[model samples]
Target: MRKLKLQVQMTIDGFVAGPDGQLDWMWIPGERDESIFEKVIDLAESCDTILLGRKMTREFIDHWENVVDNLPDSPEQPLAQLMVNMRKIVFSHTQTAINGRNLEVENGDLTVAVQSLKNEPGRDIMVYGGANFASSLISLNLVDEYYIFRNPVAIGKGLTIFTEQKILKLDSSITYKNGKVIDKYLPV
Candidate 1:
């Protein structure tokens, strides 16, 4: 069975976003290090499927598509192409359908949907989250591995995916030049 990995960027204080869903505190183009972006591309290369929440599906697909279309010679192009062509399952209860070639809708039943996907023969699955969706998956113990990219800054209050407070076994970690640390963990 392929694993389901939750990859998210977190602040030093453990929040994924500010109180109002603001992400401006994160290091952007000016401060982003190439190695951190390369790590993200490496993670994407290991996954054949992307499982996302309804709120992020549209934007995520669009962004990757734009990258593939416009950045043909850039270092991120290969990952962009893979993301654009890879199978994407967007979970939503109210949304009945998704209009795209490689996109599909999974009813918001996390357990059944995730298990069914895991039963399939394929590369690993990765979840690029919206806070609530990620929290739901974590709370249900559905994530097999976690790739937490911990940035240097701290946000005192905001939304976090790790809501249930379960202990995680640290698998590995890498620190980039820009003070961004990627911590890989497994549920204990």
Candidate 2:
């Protein structure tokens, strides 16, 4: 079975994004070290499938497909291409169809759909988010790993991590010298 990993960039205060859904407070382009960004790219490359919430999928597809070319040569291009080529499963009731070649729309029950995918033979699956969707997966104990890029800034109020009914226990956590902390948790 393929591992399902939830990868997110979060603030010190545990908010994934600002109250307005703005991620401007997180690490900007100049603030990131080249080595760290490269590492992140490599991490992204390991996944064969990307699981995304509707809003995130829409925004990402718009930017990666349309706006990537207008930008300069950087890591975003390669990341965008990688995202475009990989298999994408966008979970949403409103989205009738997913627009790319390897993209698929999954509007049925999240747990069943994800379980079916997990049973398939493939590289690790990546869950890129919207907190509500992540919370659902967390509640169902479906996520196998979490790769969080913890930025130094603290946003006092926003979306909280683990917005689910079940309690989660951290199995291990590693803090990097660059101020990014990666935490791993297993469902108890």
Candidate 3:
């Protein structure tokens, strides 16, 4: 079966987003961090498909599409192209149709859909989630690998994906120059 990998950015206090979905806590001042983008490209290179949650689909797709269309000559072009070209499956009940190439909407059992994707012949699948989806996948124990980009700041109260306790074996960890840390973990 293909592995289902997940990448998420979270605060020091372990919240993925503020109560109002504010990401202001994650922004740093005057720091141009291209290394994180490089790391993202590295992870994307290993996966052929991207799985997304309903709430995350629009913003995520729009951002990458903007990068591909507007930043053709930028340093991020390679990663943008990869993101645009990769097959995307958004599991959404409310969003039945969205505009994009290589995109599909799935409103079925999450486990069944994910399992079927895992059984397919492919390199691996990458999942970008907005808290609830990540929580569900974590609760279901469907994630094989996790890449967490941890910011230095902490928000007192917010959304978190860890609905249940998980014992993780740390595979690797790195502290970026921008003060953001990346930790790769595998469930133990």
List runs of model 2 lying over 4 Å from the truth.
165-178
| TM-score for each of the candidates | 0.92, 0.87, 0.94
Q: What are the per-residue Cα lDDT tens digits for candidate 3 across 1-188?
A: 89999999999899999997888877777765988888889999999999988887888889889999988788778988988999999888787888876899999999999999999998899987889998999999999999999998888999999977899999999998889999999988
Best by lDDT: 3
Summarize candidate 2's per-residue lDDT along 61-179 as a digit string, tens digits: 77777645666575678777777788899999887797865778998999899999989988889987988788788878898887777888898998865774655578777676667
Each model's Cα RMSD: 1.6, 2.3, 1.4
Clashes of each: 0, 0, 0
Candidate 1, lDDT over the whole model = 0.87
**By lDDT, highest first, what's the ranking?**
3, 1, 2
Candidate 1 local lDDT, 1-188, one digit each (tens): 99999999899999998887788877656776887877888888898999988987787888888888887787778778888898988899889797754899988579988998899997899998989999999998899999999989987999889776799999999988778899999999
Task: Please give the RMSD of candidate 2 to the true structure.
Answer: 2.3
Residue 3, candidate 1: alpha-carbon lDDT: 95
Q: Which candidate do you rate higher for TM-score, 1 or 3? A: 3
| Ten residues in sequence with the least summed lDDT for candidate 2 | 66-75
